[model samples]
Structures are given as C-alpha cells and as structure tokens.
Target: MKTHLTILLTLSSILTFSQNIKIPSDTMVVTTHTTTVKGANINYTASTGTQPVWDKKGIPIASLFYTYYERNNVKNRAERPLIISFNGGPGSASVWMHIAYTGPKVLNIDKEGYPVQPYGVKNNPNSILDIADIVYVNPVNTGYSRMIPNKEGELPKRETFFGINADIKYLAAWINTFVTRKSRWESPKYIIGESYGGTRVMGLANELQNNQWMYLNGVILVSPADYKLYNTSQPVYSALNLPYFTAAAWYQNALPKVLQEKDLLDILPESEQYAINTLMPALAKGGFISAEEKETVANKMAFYSGLSKKVILQNNLDVPTSFFWKELLRDKSGYTIGRLDSRYLGIDKREAGSSPDFNAELTSWMHSFTPAINFYIRTHLNFKTDIKYNMFGDVHPWDNRNNNTRDDLRQAMAQNPYLKVLVQSGYFDGATTYFGAKYTMWQIDPSGKMRERFSFKGYRSGHMMYLRQDDLVAANDDLRAFIKNSLSNGKPAKYEKD
Candidate 1:
C-alpha cells in the first residue's frame, strides 16, 4: 500500500510540473530603466510580454511578442506621441530596431556597422524615446510568438496570418486591442515599418482607419520593400535599378574617373534623369528597337553601371542585378559585393559566376544581431524564456496576392488631412533602391495635391542605415523632427486653403 501511494504521488508531481511549464499566452513582465537621450536623463518603464490573437469565437489562435517603452513621469500621456514599430520579412522579428535603431540600447559594433568580439548591447545616446513612447512588435511565428493548439490539438490555418490581406486584417485588430489595453487612443499615433514593414504600414494606414476606427498622425517607411515594384517583369522595375547601381558603383570606386571623382549625391541625379528619360523607354521597346539604339543605350548603361559595354550589349541591354554584383569588382579586385548593402564584399569560389554564393551582409548581421538580441532580452530587459529567438522564422509560402497597399496609403492620406508620411532610405541599399522608394512616393498620389505632406531623406549607408554610428545619429534626429513636425497641436483635422 505504501508503494502504491508513492507511485501516485510521483504521477501527481509530474502532472503539476507539466502544467506549470506551459507558456502563458497573455502575460507581461515590467522592468524599470533609465537612459540619457540627446543630453536629457530619461526614466522609462519597459514592459515585455506576449498578447494573444483570438479567433472569431474568442479562442486564442496565436500570441504575439512585443516590448513597450514608456517614458516615466509624463505630465499628460495623451499629449505625447506613440510610435508602433515593426521590422519586415513577413517572418523577421522586431530585433533589428528593438536593440539597434530607435531603442535605448544598440548592438556593440563598430562605427561603420561591422561586427566585433564580445557581442552584446550598449546604450544608444541617440535613442528617440525621450520625444515619444515606442513599442516593438514581433509578428506571429517570429521571436517568442507562436500559434496555440486547440483543445483537440489542431493549429490555426496558415491563410489567417501568412498573407498580404490577412496580415493587415488581423494586425489591425491586434493594434486595436493593444491601444485599448494601454489607454492610448487619445494619443497621437504613428506606425513605422522597415523593409517589408514599409508595405505593411502603408496598408495599416487605411486598415486602422476603416476597420479599427483608429487613425494615425504619421507613417514612416525605412528601406521599404514594395512588392508591386518587385516580383514583376515590368520595364520600370529594371529601369529604376540604374540609380542604385550608380550608388553602389560609386561606393566601390568602380565608376569611371570623371564620374567617380564627383560626390555620390551629385552624380545620382544624373543617373536618375537618364534612367527616367532614356533607359526606361529603350527597355520598353523590347526586340523591335534599332541595333544602333541598343548599342547607344548599352554604352550609357555601362558608363553608369560600371559594367563593360560588351557585357551590357551581350545581355541585349537588360542587365540582371546579380550579374552586376558579381561583375562589379571582378576585374578590379576579383571579389563579389553584397546584395543588400554592396558596401560589404564577399569572396567567391569562382569569379566568373553570375551571382555570389551567399549574402555577405546578412550573414555578418546575424553574427552580431542574433547574439545581441538573445543577450539583451535576458540580461537587460529581464524577460527570460527557453524558446529560441528566431532571427528569421519559418513563414514561407507567404501569400502575396491582392496587395493594394500603395493605393491604401493614398486613400488614407486623402481621407485624413492630418495624416503625413516620411520615407527614409540608404543610398547603398541595393535590395530596395532609394530610387524605387522615391517612385513609390510619387505614385502614391497621382493628383499630387497632397505632395507637400510627404518627405524623403537619404543616408550614406545601406539597407539598415542606422547601423552606422553617424547615420544612426542623423536618422534618429530625422525621426525626432518628423514626429515633432507631424503633431497636430490643436489644429483641426480638415483641409484649409492658404
């Protein structure tokens, strides 16, 4: 009988442990911290936690991880602005901007954004937290966020969270819950997205208004990726790449002596003008163009792109970006440039290939970011978890259909006179070229009536421009100016004539 009792006791203990070990779907851990930003000592509260995404029946389907930073001792919360931040990839965590860009801490890297030993994070003196509160959100399947299995052990459908329209729909609903929970409805709100997040905030601008009845004061796009411009065989897509090539070539000192001698900013306008006026039309002609015209276009493309005329004409005047990356430094240094940042160089097995073996910048970024995020979350923020921090999560087969986000932003701006936009891009960002970002801004409002509400700023870095120390200071200052300038300040939300 004693033996039987011992067995039962052991079974009960095991069950209790299992139940206790289950991760909480809705929970938060609050910690207090202080930092100096722009020469001001600021006290802030950091709330790190997970919130649930419920189904139509109110059943928890997924939980999203997020970190919220609120400046302490505020006179009035409603008067302060709230910035909701997200990083793109449709599968990337919020780690990039969380510990690096606008957050109070940044990765321990060199001034020019190269990885260093003793990987960890340090205080960012340029953090914009003093001017406004910030929240970094990790979407479902990224960071510690995960989908919950039902009582019957069935997971939610992929269509709910892995697509363009679906992403906007559910995220808008989630934002409503977050805003309501924090009692921030009255505060001036801004949504900022980087890379794919650019596409995201554009859609959210309208969705938050129409679906959630929530409006925003500003929308910020940093190195945004517009799908409409990408994933297409359109001539504009190929033509817009010229300016980016010029920027990359200038950085590598691959341009001709005359053009290379000029500043990158000075030479970029010439490339832009030629791309719009000359290259675009020539490419649009396709096979019907005269032989002499093709040769002339190829000669000019080689001049701007740093590729030989033979290579340009060999491809019939349509050069793939991959070829440019591999061939840019082929004869000069026998190296391949990075796809995202072109500033980083890679060694290839054979220099004759059309593309490099790996993305040098991404690999280098992971070396620092992966370790830094893991260490920061556990050490500084005091949020401990056994779950792996997925820098890049498994969210493949992403549905890209029905993406009308660009027009969505236009509609939002048209309806809300108070809504404004600020676009920031890095000159060396080859993935989503600065020129492509400008083109997107131009196409947003065809009527051009609300053009003044938009602004564009460029940096002398790559996709993650804030990674560089100098650009970090400049970028955050730009953000501060944008936020301050966007404030309504008792002005009514209606159009007025000067």
Candidate 2:
C-alpha cells in the first residue's frame, strides 16, 4: 500500500512539472516621442504591443499586434477623441496608412508615390495626432499578429479571423481589450479604415457598440469599398462606374476636346446624370430595347468613357472596367493604366489582354514601405520579435463570402444618433470610385434624416490619395474639421454640396 501511494505521488509531481504553465505576457516596450505639427509641440507615447484574444470560455486564441500613439498633457483623456485605424488586405498590415499619412512618421516618397532612393522616413507634418490619438491594428495573419498554439501545439486555422463575421468579432474584442487595458474606456472613440478596412469599420462600429457596449463619436472611411453596390453581376454596377471612367479619361486627356477643356468637377456631374438617367435603364431593359436605342446608348457611353462606339457595342453597351482599362491605352502604347491609381501606367506582355500584367500603383510604393517598416519597428520603436511582418501577407482562402455592411453601419447610426461619418475618396481611384461610394451612402440612409451626419469629400488622386502632396494636406484639413464638428453638441449640418 505504501509503495503504491509513493508511485502515485511521484507520477502526480512529474505531470505538474511537465505541464506548460502560462507566464504573464512579457512587458511591452513603450517609446516616448515628440513631433511638432502645425506649430504644436505634441508629446506622445508610442507603444507597440500585443493584446491577447480570448474565446467564449476565456481560452487565449490569438495575439493581435498593435501600434498605439496617445498625445500627452491632455487635461481629460476621457474627453479627447481616439481614432482606431487599420488597413485592409484581409491580409494587409496597417503600415500603409501608418507610414503614408496618419502616424507621426511618414515615408519620404515622390509626388507620384514612387520611392526616392535611400528609402528614408521623416516626421509627418500632416499627422492627425494634433486632433486625436491613433491606434494602428494588424489583424491576425498580418503583421506580427498570430494565433496562439492550441493543446495540439499547432496554430489555429485562418478561419478564426479571416471571415467577414469572424473578423468583426475578433476586432471588436481587440478594441474592447485595448481600451480597457489602456484605461481609455471613457474616451470618445472613432474608427478609420482604408480599402477593405473601410468595409471593416462599418461592420465594426455596429459590433463594437451593440455587442461590446462601446459607442463611437465618428467613423472615417478612406476609399471605402461597398460590396453591395460594387457588384459586377448587377447592371447598376457598370452604370455606377461611368463617372469614374469619365474622370480617368479626363485625367489622361482622352475625352472629347470640349469635355477635356471644362473643369473636371463641372463635367463629372454630366457623366453622373447620364449614367443614372440613361445608361442604367437601357442596360436594365437588355434585349427588349430597340436597335436604335442600343446604338444611341453605345454612342453616349463611348462619348463619356473615351472608348470607341464599336467596342462599346461589341460589349453589348456594358464595358467591364477590366476591358476599359486595357482598351483605353492599347492604341497609345499597349500600356495599361493601373486600377488602384489610374494615373500610373504599365506595359503588359500580352498587349491584347483584358487586364494589366500587374497594378503599377500598388507596386510603385511597396519597395519603400516594406523596408522602412521593418527598419523602423526594430531600430526606432524597439518592438523586437522574430515573427516576419506581413505587409501584404497571404490570408488566402480569404473568406470574402459576406461583404455587406450597409445595414451594420445604418444600425450603428440608429442606435447612436450622435455618430457621424465622413467618407473621403479620390477622383482618380478606380478601386473604390467616388460615385460608387456616394451611391452606397445614399442607399444606406435614403430618408436623408442622417444626411446631417454624413459628409463626402473628393480629391484629385488615387486610392491612397495621401500620396499626392496637395491631397494629403487637404484630406488632413478636412478630417480635422470633421472631427471637431462631430464632437460638437450643435445639430450636425448636411455636407452634400451639389
């Protein structure tokens, strides 16, 4: 009996010693920094850390990496507004926005956004830190964020944070954890998302408020994509793209001499009016329309889009953006214009192809940003980690199954009447056209009751408009005004300028 008892006690002690115990997460590295913008000396705290994600049963699921910046000396941190921002690739890290426009430091790239050699970064004079503290979050499978090892000692599958609904849940949890951990629960919150991130913030606003019990003061969407409105399967999507086509044509001087001479802003509405009233119905009618009607529609599309009537008719009066992109520049040099930024042009090995070899606009800045981020994170911020940073990592099998966020945003507004939204886009951005964004906003709040809380501003650049020096300043200025207006107690005014 004594020998059996001894064996049992020895086995129990061995099992306890072999089990992996959870030590408290390593202390995060915090760097204090200062930068003067607009003649204000801003003392700020820059901290790069990971926030653990927990499941329903409180099991740790993942670690979300984030770079947080908060301005010091604020009399009331709770009264100040905080902006939580992220970039979207479903796989992209938040570095694009952080290094491009919002963070204290920005990449010193050229006017066209191509890198100047020696790949240098400098303090961003236009940083939004003057108005609000910023947090740049990298979702799972992107940047330094990753899944925690499970009992099997394997990482969780990407499904945990890659889907539309799952993404919102994890991100909402991260935001809640971040605010609570930092003790900024009382602060006025805002969210800024670019590209798919823009799509993300819409859903996140609702999720955070309804599920997490957190309310926001405002939401800023930069080049936002609307899955509902941008559907290529619908005839309306083709029609909605006309204004952008005209804008791109205008930029390339491919439009009619009369149209080219007119101010772009003045002539764009003509294109919008034509697409809405004429092209939309004709396309919807399809085969039922008379031959004469089809001919007229084709001619009008050609006139506005700078495409030949023959090609427009060949496509059945509906030219997909891919065909237009390739066809527009084929005659000129067999070069294709970029979809992200129509301003940039590239050559394709297959000149007759419908799409370009690659997106010139996207490739232009990758060289500069990738290296700059890697260097800055390690040398400047002192956030050391062996994990490879994913500037545009593969989050493949990317669950794009559900992309609708109109209802989510609308529900958020309905729940919190004080919530304001500002959508800023560039005229030259083909990825998420300004017209498409406007249509989506209108669809979201057609009654116009929320009109007072919404604002749409357009710039003369591409998807990442801040790459242009002038647009960067203008966007920052507009954002500054928007943030102040949102926090004001006065009734919000309608910002739709006809």
Best by lDDT: 1
What lDDT score belongs to each candidate, Candidate 1 first? Answer: 0.89, 0.82
lDDT by residue (tens digit), candidate 1, 296-415: 998899899999999988887788888888989999999899888889999989988888898888899999999999988887777776777788887888999989999999999999
Specify the poorest-scoring 10-residue window by lDDT in model 2.
Answer: 1-10
Question: In terms of TM-score, which candidate is strongest?
Answer: 1
Candidate 2 lDDT tens digits, 332-416: 7677888988998887888987777788888887878888898888766777655678887667776767765788998899778
Query: Can you tell me which runs of candidate 2 are displaced by over 4 Å?
Result: 1-27, 401-404, 488-498
Backbone clash count for every predicted candidate, in the order shown: 0, 0
Structure candidate 2, residue pairs in collision:
none
Instruction: Note the residue pairs that clash in candidate 1.
Output: none
